[model samples]
Target: MRTPPNEAVATDTVDEGAGPERTCVLSRVVRPKDALVRLALGPDGQVAPDVRARAPGRGAWIGVDRRTVDEANAKGRLKGALSRAFKTQALEIPSDLGERIETALRQHALDRLGLEARGGMLVNGAERVEAAARQGKVHLLIHAADAGADGRRKLDQAWRVGGGGPAGLEFPEPRTILSMALGRENVVHIALTDAAAARRVLSAIARWRAFIDPDAGLDGGDAAGPDAGEQIRHEGNA
Candidate 1:
């Protein structure tokens, strides 16, 4: 589908200062490009997710959650919207598009973690994380989904005393996935020491987790106050 240059479709460009904005073709809501998922039309007429928004050609953005997209797809509303946006009804949208999007988002978040790890901005292992958390050197705290309850609480307390937050964000995946992402063994927890790196990682993770279930909490404690990761939700998110 060849969209005209003057069409309403969003481009893959990112503005340097305030960031590029895009409109959700379905919801008609304007939001930052990073806060929405992009759907790229391939040469074979297949509509695939461009999670990083770097795919060539024009793309359609969606701000709704996964369930909403699935519902719209089932009712043909999503196809109609895409047909209008791309000006072509020959596009093929997989029945499992929601699952594909979720998978892409999960991988993107893990990739962000791996990048930060390689850059030496984060520390893993319970002991190291706890020590750093106690000293206020930790900018972000994270725990595996299956991490022990007592262990999480201990780390949470330490982070709080060190001027962190009430609790750390819980990764959607278990320790095995997280271990592989950071190239570590039996990794149950992580502490990012750099503020910028922490924000980058959390931004990636928030989109992934929010898409799966918007009402779900990202952390495993009393969410009475805002944590470092929680701030991403309010930072121009839909």
Candidate 2:
């Protein structure tokens, strides 16, 4: 079931100097750039998602939630919104805008992970991650969606023992996706030893999660639900 949109709720606190705030054309709520998805009209008269928020020219910013996009598409609100936002009625709204945005978000997160890996800030493999956790060198722990319960518990315990690392974060992508991202064979667990890299990866993941599931708390608390880990295990087993 699709979660209902919380466009009326102001869940995010404004961060000064983070960037210029943009108003969601659908909900009329002003929020930081991180909390919104930017859409730009191309020269071909087609609208495309600018997930990186780097597209040139005027752009329409929408709240970071799938429901927002779905609703706008369903009610033909996007056409009107784009026309007003860009001051053009010739723009074309793609039927798969939502799906494209989702794919872009997933790719963006994976790309960030790949960059972190290249920077030597990320360590993979269960044993290596556990060792980093034990040494208190891990600033963030990332567990693949399909990671086994035993492996996850082992590293969780190690992180607890180390006592300074943040709680283990479960990536929504499976082990295969994680492996491909880091150019590894079978990545089930990863540790971010550098604080800056961890924050960058976390920010990317948070933006994707917020777009897919707005209810997810991006601050390491109940990303999906109270039983997110259990749900992941169940899905993996299935």
Candidate 3:
């Protein structure tokens, strides 16, 4: 049975705002366009991921996980779906389309962090983040994958005390990657104070993580929630 795409609504932690709906070519399930990953067809009929959904013209959407997408591609299911979505059989689907989609999603998440940082929506450094978290000013918390366990615990406790949430989202990459993304040095932890900024970052991170590791819990918990990083786990469960 095909489930209708859930309606997107503005929330402090789920989505920044409401947007158009799109249908997933593979599952035939309708969903908020922002909740699905877009694939654009180029001039040469080459299909590519439009993670930002900024590409013009016709496009196909998919709400499935990376493994499913890869399996479909290998078995020609994706090709057939794309053919129907694009209304033609002349398009070319890259063998590494799964890799491409993952890469694009990863980059988009990083880019969103950078943009938020540049706009002064987030603060880095353990001390600063801890201070913000303690004051109840943090809307979102993030930690590099390689962040020390002790450090993460301290910050998570502080965040909870300050009313931030359960814990922070773990970036798939290490400190070096986060540092480069935010144009900082050794960015181990970050705190986003603005609600809209937090929503955007959470949305991007949620989508990326969902495709990469669907079953992983937010902050290693059995389940996820907005105040407890629920949006990340819920965003891509399409």
Off by over 4 Å in 1: 1-18, 220-230, 233-238
How do the residues 1-238 of candidate 2 rate in per-residue lDDT, one tens digit apiece? 0011211111122332355678888889886666577898899889998878788888998874887887888789888988999998998898889889989888988998998899898899888988987877776678898888788779877975665333477788899999999999999999888765766676677667878876655433423323232211000000
Q: 157, model 1: CA deviation in Å?
A: 1.0
Instruction: Give candidate 1's whole-model lDDT.
Output: 0.77
Each model's TM-score, in the order given?
Answer: 0.87, 0.82, 0.87
Clash statistics: count for each candidate: 0, 0, 3
RMSD of each: 9.2, 9.0, 6.2
The residue-by-residue lDDT of candidate 1 on 1-238, one tens digit each, is 0012211111111222236778898899887777789999999999999988888997999988899999999999999999998899999999999999999999999999998899999999889999988887887788899999899999988887777766787888999999999998998999988766776777777678768977765553336243222234212221
The deviation in Å at residue 62 for candidate 2 is 1.2
Pick out the ten consecutive residues of candidate 2 with the lowest summed lDDT: 229-238
The weakest ten consecutive residues by lDDT in model 1 span: 1-10
Kindly list the per-residue Cα lDDT of model 3 for residues 1-238, writing each as its tens digit: 0011211222222332346678889988776777789999998999999987788999999988899999999999999999999999999999999999999999999999999999999999999999988887887778898999899889888977775566677778899999999999999999988766777777787677777877774343322245442332123321
Off by over 4 Å in 2: 1-17, 216-238
Model 3 backbone overlap count: 3
- CA lDDT of every candidate: 0.77, 0.71, 0.77
